[model samples]
Target: MNKKEYLEKLESELGQMSYKDVKDIMDDIGEHFDEGVAHGKTEEDIAAGLGSPEELAKSFREGGTVASVLQKKQAPVQNARQKDTTASAIFVILFNLFVAIPLWIAIVCAIFTVGAIEIGLIAGLVGLVLAIPGFGNFLAAGICLAITIALAVVFVAVLIILVTKYFVIGTGKYISWNKKIWKEGL
Candidate 1:
């Protein structure tokens, strides 16, 4: 089948998944098809080499989360810490397993809380435009309100960037922890 047909079949197979997730998967595979075509391979050739989308989708479903898919895609860092024989290094890995999750939850919660507070501050500023005396000029108030809203949007965008950065850092750290815990036992 053609690229479109193959992806459609895959999407149908992954019917229960989020549309965003399916689109991301299709985008990744589509890039592979593009690369193959660049090298003079046909869509059918690419699809055949990749195997049936149904089976692929089934494997992904069995894997559970998007994080698993992501971890599968990214390669391991070459200079991954050696099986350090130090005492604190081992302690840190074990301590992190239980501790880091709560830390991540707290970070996520803090980001949410900060975003909420910023938006609430914007709302309060808008209210102040009506409540305050000299600052109540309609045109000025409208402009200030728009500026405040824009700032809030920027704040959220920054939060998204920060959270994504945290996710990447956390994923690498977890991989290191897994290696230390499973590969090099105490």
Candidate 2:
């Protein structure tokens, strides 16, 4: 049989093996076929030299060289990938405790302060309008000054609100990223 046919039959014979095991076997066999072809051997000859797929699968099941090699290759790779996530978890916890929480509290205080200032401005404007008769001469100048200052405060409050919104969104995204790293590794 050709390389493809041989591999298909071998894969069928390896049905009881784990996916990784079967894949390793197939890859090794395919490489042998490639090397044999490079040395001017036919696929039939190579497949014959490798022996029947059933016997090969039996050898693999019986802890053959391929099985041993697969075990050796997987052991080191699994260990290498098995990272300790304790550091990342600790960093996130410490940062939230020492930095993020304080920043969030400060942002909340700023928001409340801005809201109060806006309300005070509105009340002052209402009071000024009500006491218009008493301010006769200075009323126009006072009104203009109050309006300008109110506009400035309103602008500042709006900016703070926008900044707080983005800060919250960015913090949420950062927390989500940390959570992903905790689960999946960095």
Q: Give TM per candidate.
A: 0.35, 0.58
User: Per-residue lDDT for 120 in model 2?
Assistant: 81
Q: Could you give candidate 1's per-residue lDDT for residues 28-114 as a string of tens digits?
A: 999999999999999999999999998999977888677787886664532242444354466666677678767878877887787
RMSD, model 2, all Cα superposed?
11.3
Q: Rate the local accuracy (lDDT) of all candidates.
A: 0.77, 0.83
RMSD of each: 27.0, 11.3
Q: For model 1, what is the C-alpha lDDT against the true structure?
A: 0.77
TM-score of 2: 0.58
Off by over 4 Å in 2: 1-63, 76-83
Per-residue lDDT of 117 in model 1: 76
Per-residue accuracy of model 2 over 1-186 as CA lDDT, tens digit each: 989999999899877889999999899999999999999999999999999988987778787676688899999776655554665567778878999889888888988888888778778877776776688799898788778867876797788779888988988997898797666555
| Backbone clash numbers for all candidates listed | 0, 0
Residue 19 error, candidate 1, Å: 88
lDDT of 1 at 14: 86
lDDT, residue 116, model 1? 76
